[model samples]
Target: MTLVAIVLGAAVRPDGEASPTLRLRVEHAVALYHRGAVAAVCVTGGVGRHGPAEAEVAARLAMSLGVPERDVILEDRSRTTVENIAFARPLIGVHQVVLVSNRWHLPRAWVVARILGVRASVSGPRGRMSTSRTIAATLREVAALPSTVWRAWILSKRSAPKPEPRAR
Candidate 1:
């Protein structure tokens, strides 16, 4: 089975170029490809604030970084992190993957991926951080977690078997 790398996207510039966050995501996926850890990369995102499909920018970057064209699949209709995993599910099948994104974002992305039945491990770039940025992003993540977990719980309940009715 092929190993896939799932790279989530961020907003781009007005000129339809990749943001630093998105660029790093693409780079991490490419590095994983070079290391033989993954055989394909799925770039996931729809139109971001800058108006270009984020996956398209990522695919271009991946190709520029030497990942073969055939191995880079664009999932270009997802507007959110959950959508990223949900949209990539069919492409991924049962393959294992390195899920690439910023450190602060991957936890929620991982949670959503599991809910969608994708097997993945997180990979973020190694870098120095601004303490303020890290704390702010983390705080936002914590605020978002409850809704994601609640969605997981609700979906699980729906799939579970109903209990037998008690006798009158």
Candidate 2:
């Protein structure tokens, strides 16, 4: 089975540098590439307030880590988590995807991506995790749960095909 790594993006500084979270995502994706676990990586994000497009930063980082330029597919028009999955679906085609992101961000990402029509799995970076950041993210995710579910419902409804007309 073809497995494509999905390296989700985070903020980039005005200097066009990736955020720590984004860097971690790329690192994980690159590791997967080296392990032969992934055939390619799709880096997703649009232009942020302070930097170039997040996908651009991610793709560069992956390439620098020896992921190879040809193996990195940049989905550089997604400004939201929803857009991330929606936009990547086309570039990703029907490949099984392993998504890399912060631990606290994975559940919604998995659910949202599946609803958006991708077969996906999630992973957080290996090694030490800051408890404080996890706490903060956990709280935010808890708060966002209701609205996330609502949006998923609406999106699912929108993606559903309309009934075909009966024979005249």
Candidate 3:
């Protein structure tokens, strides 16, 4: 398999540290690097209101994990799921990809990848900071599902091939 890229979702911290979720994603990317499965890693996320951009933090973490700086691609402008997929397209060339993120964000992330025409699978981190945070994130994702689906649908439509005419 030609695994070209691994996409990591950023997690923000209140104290300007990389969140646990983001760290897990970086760990996963590092594992991929060890396995030689992916040629490069794409870290996606913009700065939060209180912290540095998630993608930049992720890229730094990956480098610290022994991934070469050249192998890390940064999509440091995205603040949402849709922008994550959209912004990473030019940086990702692999047909198959492993997407890493929090479990609560998988559905939207996977949908966005599909919309972008990448064959992708999601790996989510286990553990929770608090039940309330988990519940809230899940509920918010559920509420956003319709809009996510709509965005994917629009993207797919725009990228789909035109139908040929029937023979006379």
Arrange candidates, best TM-score first: 2, 1, 3
Of the candidates numbered 1 and 2, which has the greater TM-score value?
Answer: 2
- Candidate 2's residue-wise lDDT over 1-168, tens digit each? 898888887899878999877898889889989999899999999998966999999999999999889899999998877778777878877647898887888888888877766788887786355788778888998788778767866877887789999998
Q: Report the poorest 10 consecutive residues by lDDT, candidate 1.
A: 152-161
lDDT to native, each model: 0.84, 0.84, 0.78
Q: Residue-wise lDDT of candidate 1 within 1-168, one digit each (tens)?
A: 777889987888899999878898889889989999888999999997887899999999999999999999989998878777767777766546778988998899888777755677998886446889889988999899988777765654675569999999
Off by over 4 Å in 3: 156-168
List TM-scores for all candidates, in order. 0.86, 0.91, 0.80
Top TM-score prediction, candidate number:
2
Worst 10 residues of 3 by lDDT: 2-11
